[model samples]
Every structure is written in structure tokens, then in C-alpha cells.
Target: MFNGSPFPVDAFPQIIRNAIYEVEQHTQAPQALIAASALGVISLACQNRIDVCRLNNLRGPVSLFLLTLAESGERKSTVDKLLMEPLYQLEENLFEKYTHDLTVWRNDEAIFNIEKKSLMSKLKSEIRRNKDHLATNEKLKVLLASHPKSPVRFKQIFNDATPAAIKDYLCGYWRSVGIMSDEAGTIFNGYTLNELPFINKMWDGAMFPVERKSEPEKLIRDARMTLSLMVQPNIFKGYIKRKGDMAKGIGFFARCLICQPGSTQGNRQITSPVVSTEYLPIFHQRLMKIVNESIARNNENDRLCLRFTVEAEKRWIAFSNNVEYEMGILGRLSNFKDYASKMAENMARIAALLHHFNGDEGDISLLTVEAAVEISTWYVGEYVRLFSKPQEFTLAISEADELYWWINNYCIRLKASWITKNTVLQYGPNKFRNRSKANEVLNTLYSQNRILTEKKGKTVFIAIAGSIF
Candidate 1:
């Protein structure tokens, strides 16, 4: 239903473009290409080492939630695996190191526990014998405080995990991670997962509290997660229909960057493997470097913050004002005001991600901000086309056309200049689901001047606007 092209793939950086081209060569879906590239960038951003974007006291994170609508066999999972291969490798390396460290920590912990228990026994005996016990008790307390805790495994990617499990992982390991799933139905259909609030809070970098009755302590952690979900259009629509307005009413869908790209199913030709010829090695190297730097910086609890240059600030402000103006106008984007309102923040986030991806450590440049704005505009268009009831609009038009055809063919064949509502409803091309819907269609036709309505003896009749008997 969208009138324009897909995301501006050319506007991305050279590395991103090369990755997209490589994926597209394998899969003919351009939407899959863009989604895969964006997923890669967001997965890198999940490191949480990069500084936030600050402008006049407003700050935003580089994390994003992207959803792509495609049918099965669109190669969505293939593209996801291709881009996330490096992260999987990184996880494997970290797991090996974690296993080694865990073994050493367990040995040290056993020694510490035995020593603490011996000291506690001595302290209790001294207390019973009326001897000095303060020193021994103090020593036991110090040992307990200094005991080595268990090593937490380093993990950055997840698929098909429940909300509680994800929370536990984020609270124990890195506070940032990415959820990449080709079939998002598992997530959407999970009845036990309280995902709406969990996802919303994570997107805003808010604290999530996990309480357990078995343990006396509670954990409150700030978690950041990036989501890349690729689902078939039919499945997505089914979710929407079942959930009704819940997703939009709660602003879940509004926060997402959604795209439903035109399919190239039958047109895809068998092509040779382009992965070897592409710059994937270089791309993987850059991603690994970024992840390593992020891990190093985060280990030291150092955050790298960036602000816009003066020119970039001015451009950002102008873009914000323009979007605000457009949203205030009636019918401009009334159906999508929620999504439109967040466009500015989303644009800033994109700019920050682009700035980091370009390996720029300085202030964000005006060119970068401009490019972000351009891409954000495209995202807004995609949001409207995908979620603004364009299909319903098309259905209405089709029903109107069917009614018009019926009037011309049936009514004119009978040599009747007018048709009663009852007759039309009985013989109409089944364009309506019920009597009320039929009435609505007839009223719409009357309002459009396609037909004239008359009331005679409590019966309403419709006639072609310019027809002659």
C-alpha cells in the first residue's frame, strides 16, 4: 500500500551497504536486506558502552526495536544468521573464558567457606567461655564480605526466551542484550510472558524489579534490549485482530520501527554465493572491534557520550519543529500521532548509532543528523503504510466499486431509475457484512454524489446521480 520505495539503503554507511548487498544477492527481498543490516547495527549498539545523545537536557539511547513483515520462505532467518554469526562467535569465546574462570572461582570459594566456618566456630566457643570474641567475629565478617562470588556467563543474544528469563540474564550478566527472532509468533502468543511492560521499560532504560519469595532480597536492575522480529504479514494481522487496540493503546507498536517490504518471491533467480566476494570479513572485524572496545570501556564503568555540533543541533531542532507542526494538523497524521510524536527521539537515536558505526568519536556532524532525519522520514512513511489501516481503506473503496457496478447492471437492466435500500441490500454483491454495514456503504455513496437518496413512504431509495430513464 505504500507509494514509495523501501528504506533508503543507499544512505547507510559503506559497511552497511556492502552487508545489505551481500544479503540481497542471496535473498531477493529488499526488506530482508534492510532489516538484516539494521539488526546488525542494533546488535552492536546493545553493548551499552556508547554514550547517549544529549540535546538541551533531552537524552536518548541508541537502542531500537525493529519489526519486519514478510511471508514464510522470504529468507528472513537466513539473513539473520548471516549478520549475527560474528556475535555468536564472540559468545563462544566468552563462554570458554567464563568456564575457566568459574572453575578457579569455585576452588577459591570452597576454601573461603571452610575458613569462615572454622572462624565462626571459634568465635562461638570463645563467646561461651567468656573470652574475647569480638576480634574473631569481626574476622569472620570480613572473610564473608571478601569471598569471591560466582562468575556470571557473558551472553549478548537470545531467541524465544520468556520475559522473566531474560530479566534474570540481564540482571546477572551484561545489562544489555539483543533479541533476534525470525518467527515472532512465539513471543506474540506467549500468554505467561508479561512482555509489554518489560519491553517498554527496557526501551526507556527504566529499572525492572524481580522479587522472589524464596529469597529475602530483591533485585532491581536497569536493562537495555534491542529487538529484531521478522514475522509473516498474515500472522501479524492475526495478532492485531486478536489483540484489537491493545498494542497501539499501550504504545507498544508505536515505539517500534515497522516495515512491510514488497515481496520478490517468484522473481528471485538462483545466484552464486556472494558472501565470499563481499566485504563480510571486514564488516565482521569492525563489529568485533566495536564489541571489544565496548566491553573494555563498560568493564571500567566508563560511558562515551556524544552531543551534536552547533550546526547539527540547529538542524535537529528544525526537524523536531517541522514534525511537531505536521502532527498538529488535522488528518495529516491523526491516525499515527503516537508514532509521529516519537519520530524526533528515534531520529536522534539513529543519528547516534550512525555516528558510532562510522567510528566517529567526536560530536555528531550535521551530515549525520541530516541522514538520520531522511531515514526517519522513510520510517514514518512505512509506519503509516503498514499500520494506518490502508488495507481497510482499500477494502472500503472496493466495496464502493462493487455497489456502483451492481446499480448500473441490475437496476438499469430492469429499466428502473431508482432502487430501494431493501432491494439493493438483498441483491448487492455481498459487499457488506450486515445491514448496518450496507447502510454505511450507501450513505458513503450518497455523500460522494455517486448516488441520490430519496424518502418515500418511509422507504429510502437510491438512484444514479445522472441517470435518465
Candidate 2:
């Protein structure tokens, strides 16, 4: 999965392609990671304003949930910031405006309250003094109707948040939202697994009416959220280990476009131009233009529908049929029904985003749809690579590799040919301190010619293979 085929960057629009390449040159991260970040930013901005027609003929938000798997120091933060710099600036601008609006609302609300109190008192006195109470009552009614309401704070992105906090903000406070992180342990380990169903609803753009004990029950509609997380490979595996069954059972992982791109650590040689001053600024400006257009219109039900043209619709339907038929019992996609079924919709969504970003008029074209297909087909292949085999074996292989390195390092650092098994039992990795577990991993190393073990009179010793005796 880590060495999967490279993402189809050439298929992207020229505007996005240029920035991706620029980020790659500067960050030396995998292009796929950078691409995911770019798409996530687009999705977050477009989700509030645009709706695309899916195969079901129903309109769905052009939003995406992207999860990219990379190792530590893979420049996840660098890639995320490079793509989201424009959005960060937009948030700061919105916050400043909101602060001013809130202050004004406070003053108006206080005056409104004072007027209402005086009007009520006058109405009571008019009734007591046998005067015309109808005029005072009418005045009070007008004042009550004109009561000031506070401004709604507009915040679009959260680096990390819980389900409740997300609901509070995205469901009503802001129509569009995104939750992104470079190191995503806070998201994965912060009780997010328990709230998979909440995220699933957000992905489908389904209406969510939440029940509250102390507050009014809220009905949420026309809400959109995009989630993008870049986690280390180990944390990625840990998430699968803990919630694989629940996530698969409820089709949550199926809703995400998960990519495990290969690393580019040692290959980043210093180049003449260390940064991309030109391309990134251009991309940020264009991105800001798109986002500002969406927000300025205050589009709620007024959606800019991105439908497929005649030929593009045919292309999409053919792809959808092929995916359905390939999910048969004896079919190639039999083992991947959950993920394969969702890929075509994602293709349409991605195609719509590409079309709109390029400022194409009318319907989407077959050329754009084909490009989306190329990208989605690679995602199916990557999903199969990660989930085809039993995960237990994968975990074992990873542990074996770790133990082998630790053994070799221990032996070399101590200037010893072998280490006593008792020492391993006492001082090795915590999980391998036991006899049975240690042997399970040691036997794997032995079979791979990484280590040799000997027993001498009830004591066992292990040494790195090919070491001088």
C-alpha cells in the first residue's frame, strides 16, 4: 500500500497541477499527499455552495473526506499549510469582522432590552389609569418584534474538534466546514471512532436532527463538512486495528478516499530554487477567488448544479454498471463491494470540482470524467492493497521488522556477539518480554536469516546472523 502507483497529477487542471508540482519541488513530499490536500481545500470551500447530480439523480454536496497515510517527518504539515494558506487567511479575516459585529450586536441588544422594559411599564400604567391601553400594547408588540439578535460567528475550519463541537459549528453556525490535521492522533484517538456514524451522515449530506437535553432540539440541513487527516503509518494501522470492524460494518471507511503514498525522505537533494514563490501565490489567489464567490452569494438552497453532459453521463453510467457487475460473487470486486460502490460517486464529485474550478460553463465533459475515473481507479487498487489480506499478518510482519532492528542495534552497541535470552526477557520491547510472544517474533527473524539462536544448558542466547563469533 505504501508503494502504490503514483497519483495521476497530469490529469488535474493546469492551475492545480502547477501548484502541486511546486509544492513537490519545495516539500519533497509525495505528490499524492499534496494532491489530497488540494482537493480537500476545494471541497471545503465548494461544499457550502455547490451541489452535483449523482447517478441516483439526486443532488449531493460536492464535498469529500480525504485521509492520507504517511510516515512521521513526511512533511504532512508542510503540504497542508501550502494548500490551505489561503483558507487560513480567510478565517482570520472573518474572525475580525465577527468580533466587530458581535460588539455592535451587544450594544443594540442592551438598548432593545431597555426600551422593551419601559414600554411594558407604560402599557401597565395606561391600563391602570383608564387610558387607551391599545396604543401602549401595540408599541410593546412592535418593540418585542424588533428585538435584536446577536450575530452568528462564521468560522470555517477546525484543526481538531469533537462531534458535539462540530455539530454546534457546522450544523448551524456555519453551513460549510472542514476538520484537518497534520499529525492526526488527536483526531483518531480523541473518541472519534465512537462517532463514526455522525461523520457518515455528514459525508452523505443527510439531514441531522439532534436531540438536546438542556437546549432546543436542532434540525440541521444544507450542512456540509470536509475532513482531511494526514496520519503516520503506525497511527493509521492502529485506527484500522481498533475500529476496522465498526468502520467497515457501517461503511465509514468507504466514504473516505484513503491514500498511502510512498516516502521521499532521502531523495530530496537541495535544488537551486528551494521554494515556489510564483506558483503557490497564484494558486492561493485563485483559491481565494473561488471561496469568496461561494461565501459572498450566501448560497443555501440556491445551488450551482454541476450536471454531466450527454456523453459524460453515458461515461459515468457505464462506469457505474461495470462497478456493480464486478461486485458479483465470482467477480474481481467481490471482496470490495463497500468501497467499489462508492468510487463512482466520488468520481462524479471530483469531476464536478475539476470542472467548476476550471470555470467551465454548461455541463461536465467526457474528458473531465475520464480524468476523474483514472484517479478513482487508482484509489480502488490502493484500497484492495491495504485490506485484501488478513491484517493480523500485516501487524506481525511490522513487529518482526521492528524486533530485528532492535536486536541488531543492541548487539552492535554493546560490542557483543550474542545477548542472553534472559536479558531480552528483561530489557526488550515490552510486548516481547514474554517467552511465547518473544519466540513468535524471534522465529520469524530466524526464518528470515536475521538472527540465530542457541540453547546452552537451560539458558538461551540470540545473535544477529553473520556476526563474527
Candidate 3:
């Protein structure tokens, strides 16, 4: 199998890049996994306070749904713990305040019930005696208006939850929260994902209603959720084998940025002076600032819609058009149409995430959007690599084909019988230069008899097949 490309860490802003570097150095986790963990933290802090306005004036959530596949000993939990330390710390503090508030609410409710009952009895007595009763009626109205209101319980993260429980929390406790789990089997293997369509709706920030036999119908609106899941490969495979039809039919997986990065185990050597866990404190400190600001403005009318600069909007329009055109029946991206369709909007979300995390002033800029495009393109390729059939053109196979086309073009244009490996590495497609992936593609093309590779002295040359030229 072809290995996935390393994440484009430099494309991210300095704050996020530092966090990713620190986490990867300290834990030796896959770079892509650490990047995804960083994104989840950004989503939790920004989703409630900010939104992204698309090129066409469409406003959407500044949230992301991420899924990472890895084995048991890949340090998935470590990445999550390091990045999400702020959220957990905040949740702990909130729980203490909630415990105290619950006590006060119970006492107030008891006093309210006693006063209400007394007024109700007094009203009946006054009515029976045919008295004026105006004073009693006024007292009852005042009493009803003064009825105690229980505090809205607060929580920020959950490993596993039912839809009803989620609605209750968002409606009563917090306006925004996240479903972050390292052992995602509890969510994927259980009933949480049984309602595939509901999960998809949650990702899109759509309105949801639940009808119950025992109570009134509930409508969930203006509530936001961000999901980051890390599951074992076998567990995810089983879920897809059993329920992929339903999930894919409803476009559940398309809403996610999915990856299964090659493992880095057995290579994390213990150095004499271990790498410092630096920048985590900075990550936490910056995130808590956003959290404090978001908490003060997590209402329906308070979201800060991040508009793109003029240059950024033009770039986005061009990108959307290009991707849409590539989704034709015979187009290379035809098989992964669902992902291509939503990728542009997700790119906008990524730009907003980076912009907010870096404390950039004013609107989202062209530079940020371009960097976001680079990151999104890599993940989309990863999605295709993981989901497409073997014979189908995976990203690696696509790179190989592009390289072969380049060789043929070079022969025709330059009148050269062959090209050097160094030339291909320096002057080929940007995706064609990674030595490991490039070598694998060369070997695969050779097995297919599609190209000829010749060695002369210290140089390697590639030429088209049937070299009658």
C-alpha cells in the first residue's frame, strides 16, 4: 500500500504550526493525526462565536468533522489529550460551579412550591366566601411570575451521547459542544450512529426535530456540534462493511475530512534529552481566550460572520468552478463527487479557523485562503486514497499516470530519448517529487510495462514504452 503524504504544516498559521510541531515531536504521532487534533480544538472554540461567509454570500458554520483511522498503539489518545487539555480543564471548573448551583436551585424550588400552594388555597377560600378576591388574584399572579428557574447545566465534551441527550445539553446547558473520542468504537459500534441521517444533519448545522410518544416534540436550532473521532482500522472497516451503504447514501462520510496515516511506531527512539512539550501552554492559553469570548456571545444573534477579502472571494469562485468541472462523468474525480462537492465550503471553514486562531485582524485574507486550499487539497486526496477501489485511480496512481504523461511529453517536445531521475524530481509535477512515493510509482509502472527505466553510469532515465522513436 502507498503511504500517505505528510501534512502541510507550514501552510498553517504560526500558532497552529507550533502546536502541531510540538505535539508531533513530543508524542511521535502521525503529523496528520496531530493536525486533526489541533483542528478539533479550534472548532470547539470558534464554532459558536464565528461563521464563514462564502463567495456567494452564504453563511455557514466554522466547524469541522474529522475522522482518523489508526491502530491501538499509535498514540491517538496522546494527541487528543495534549490539544484538548484546555477544554477538559474548563469543563472541570464548570462542573464545580454547577454542583453548587444545583443545591441553590433545589432549595429555591422547595420554597416556591410551598408559597404557590398557600396562595392557591387562599384563592379557593376567598372565592367560596364570595369576597372581592382582587388582592388574592394579584398575589397569585405575582407568585407565578416569581417561580424559580433552574440553572442551565454546562458541559463541553462527551465521549458518547444519544441524540436526545445532546439536544438537552445544547438547549439547556451549552449552546456549543464537541464529540471528541480516541476510542471511537463507543460511538461507531453502538447506537449513536444508528441514525445516519441525523448525524449528517448535525454536521451541516441544519434544523432537527424529535417526536416523542411520552412528551411534546422538541426542535433543536441554533446549536452547533464539532466531531473528532479516532478509531481502530478494523472497527471502522467493520462499520463501513455493515452500514456504509446507509451512511454513504445519506452523505455522512462526505462531510468529514478522513485520513489513515501510516503508522510511526517502532521508530520513536528515546533520546537522551527528550523533546520538550513546548507550546501546549500557549495553545491552551490562546484557546481559553477564545473560549471566554465565545462564552459571552454564544447566543443566536451573536455569531461573528467572517467575510473573505475580495481577492479571496475571487480565488474561491475559481476553485469552486474548477472542482465542479472536474466532477464530470469521465473526469478523474468522478468517483469521489460527494467529497468534491462539499470541499469548497469546507475550505472556507478552514480559512476562518486559521484566521481566528492566529488573531488576525479584520476579514479573512487571500493568503490565508490559499494556504487553506493547499491543506484541503491534501486531505481530499487522502479521502480518495482511502475510499477508492484498488484498480481505480488512487491519488498515488494518479501521480504515477501524470508522471508517465510528463515523460511522453518530454520525449516529443525536447527530442530527448530519456529524462534523468534528478530532472523528474526537480521539474515534474509538484506531487511527483516525494522520493518514496515516486519510486513506488516507478516500480508499479514498470510492472505494467508502461515505461522503460534505463541506468547509465550514475543517472536513471525514463522513456515511453515501445521506444521506436
Candidate 4:
């Protein structure tokens, strides 16, 4: 008989935000795979003294080809220790220190003080005001595009979207992590702890407008529901809407948020800059794998929070908010939520840097959530920034390195169903071309068109594609 109605629907948006935070607490699938591969490549380069050879020969295509050809080391006690031991030791030491800081998040006094802040008050108000609007089953595309305050308000909606219990639970986990500093009170820098949407938009770019072609009303409903589920009790600690100051300091660390081939260029703070659709799922898949692994490793229970997963998908699906433009300057950007969510993920990395110094697991976790929020924000901001500053990131690289970067970074880790649908390996050359072959793959993964399939069948392919877990 118990349901989640008593909680404000406005708060629901924050829950959807958990996917972003959970992502921050973890890594993206592609990033991890590339990082691991990079480690291996870098290791070999260092060992063989082939650094110059690797770097010089590193074109995108060659890099990818090399990845396939790279040899693996045997399981030597010393070899494993030499490579993984140090990192594991570092993590253990860090975790030990992290637990001490977690006390701050756990204490009732600390929790109460955070909830008492000005940010939470405004967020609560925003939630009430926006509730009925979202309930109308109107597509977010038209509503966000047309609204003058779409950018800021949309964040509020998103920030407030998660459920209260889940938020509290995540907060609890942060407390468990115990990673905060005295000068900065908590590990998270700018995320007002209680702040709602303001911080989410500030460092990140504003939300972009786009047109929706699907069943508008249904999509909106699904989005809302999905977002709500993301922050439900079982997922990430409620919805953390703000990344606060911790997110702002790390803006200078990267290459480019939107590295499109042509058309919309540069890296400014925008929604989804137009990028190749071919690459979107790949990028998402990479991140999703990291998230799933983190969930499996961290959550006390085995079940992955439904709301968290849904929230992640919603981010990838948002027409104007989630995607970027690549070569073409025409046509509307894809889903908003999805695009914005990706930018938010990028911003979060900065916040995580700060939390790392605190040595608190709980605080680290909080910071992780905050960092994820920042990345999502960044993804969006970078999209917006592209229009004015086309050609922002001018880092030079050989064509081969670039190709490898794309393949290693995005392609192998894709999250969309089309990945299974279009693969040639499943049934030779006729795989994608043959409906039966493609369907066979789909059937193996999902339940041949049934509404729901066995839980085991839902492998969270996006996560598995790039996961260590």
C-alpha cells in the first residue's frame, strides 16, 4: 500500500539527477576502458622504451589497431603487484582516511544544518511551482525551448526531481565516506549542499531548445517517471542538484567539451552542441559501464536502483540538453536531458579532485555526486559555448591518434539498442541486414518483444560493455 506520493513531485526531479551523481561517484565505461588500456599501453611504452614510437605513430586508426594488437601480461605475483598493487594500496589507504570524514555526513547535526541552508529552501519552492507544469504530459522540447527561463528553471526541475529518501540515503553514504575539509566544510566545493538548480546551470552552460518528434506527451511522462525512479530510495543518495564552488575550479583541466568535426565548433557552455549521432551512444555507453560497476561495488545490496538507471537514460534522451552538433549545422539537436546530463558528468570530475584531498569516504562520495553534477553541467555548457566560440579546443593530434581516441573513448562502449541491432559479428555480413539475425541478438538480450524479460537477461549492456565489474 505504501507509495511515494507524500513526497513533493518537485523533489522528484533531483532523483532523476542521481544517475549523474552516481556517474560522478564512479567512472564512465569508455573512460575506464581507455584508461586501463592506456595504462597498459603506457606501461609497455615505458617498459620497452617505445614512448616516442607509440606517440608518433598514434593516429586515431593506428591507435585503435594497436589496441587490438596489444599483448596482455601473464598473472605474475610480482607483475601484478608491480602494476595493480600500488594502485590498490593507494585506494585502501585513501579509503581508510575517507571513513573518518564520513562522520560529518552521518551525524544528525550536520545533516540538519545542511538541510537548513538557503539553497534547500529555494529548491523546495521551485519544486512546488513547477509540479503541475511537468504533470501536463507536455513534451519538454516545446516547453523548455519556448520558456524564457528554460535554462535555469529546467535545472531546478532536475535538481528537485529526486525522491527525499534516496537523497537522504546518498547523503548517508557520503557521511560514510567521510571526506570533507575544514575550510570547505564538506568535500563538495560549490554544490550548495542544499542548493538546487542555480549551481547546476552556472558552471555548466544553459539549457538549449529543441523540437521533439516522438509521441510528445508520452515521452514527457516517461521522462518524468524515469527521473522520479532514478532518485527513489534504492538508488543514489537522493538528487543532488548543485555542484557549488568545487565544480568551478576545474574548468581548465580538459581538451574540449564539444569537439565536433565541423559546423558547430569550440567549447563554450551550451546545451548539447551538435555532434555525430553515431558517437553519442558510444559515449553514453562508456559512461554507463562505469556507473554500473560502481553501483555493483558500492551499494550494500545487490539491486541497482531503478530510478538511477532510468535517470541515466533520460539524460541521454533529452533533445536539446544532452547532445552536441558535429559536422552539420542544420537540424535540431537530439534529446535535451541526455545531452545536458553528459555535460554535467564532465563538470563533476573537477569536484572529485577537491574531495580526493579530504581523505573521507563519505565526503568523497558526496563530492563524487557533486562532481557528476558538474560534468553534466559542463557537457551542457560546452554545448552552448560552441556557437560563439567555434574552434575552441585547438589541440593538435595525428589523424590516427584521433581515430583511436574516438574508438577507444566512445565506440566500444555504446549504450543504445542499435549497437546490438547493427553489429556484423553476430551473424556475419548479413547480421544487421537480416531482420532475423538482428532480432536473434535482440532476443538474447531482451525478451523477444515481451513487455518484460528475465532480470538476468537485462545485462545493462551499456555498463557491461565497458565495466571491470
- Comparing 3 and 4 by TM-score, which wins? 3
- 1-469, model 1: which lDDT tens digit per residue? 4364667777767776677776676666665345544554554554386646666766556778888887787777777777777878888898999999999999999999899889988988999999989899889889989989888788777777777778777767577788777777776666412468778777777777776678555454555678778878887888888774777877777778888877777888876544444566666777778888777665565556678999998998898877775553222354578887778877888888777776776899998898888788887877866664433587777788788778878776998888877887687767553677887676556545688665557676778889742
The TM-score that candidate 4 achieves is 0.16
The models' CA-based lDDT, in order, is 0.73, 0.82, 0.82, 0.26
Model 3 per-residue lDDT at 290: 95
lDDT of the structure predicted as candidate 3: 0.82
Candidate 2 per-residue lDDT, tens place, 330-359, comes to 245667789987988898899998888777
User: Comparing candidate 1 with candidate 2, which one achieves the higher TM-score?
Assistant: 2
Candidate 1 local distance difference test against the native: 0.73
lDDT of 2 at 110: 90
Say which prediction, candidate 2 or candidate 4, comes out ahead on TM-score. Answer: 2
lDDT of 2 at 346: 90
Worst 10 residues of 3 by lDDT: 325-334
Please tell me which model should have the higher lDDT, number 1 or number 4.
1
**Candidate whose TM-score is highest:** 3
> What tens digits encode model 4's per-residue C-alpha lDDT throughout 119-179?
4455456577875444333343344344332111001012222233223322322111111
All candidates: TM-score = 0.76, 0.79, 0.83, 0.16
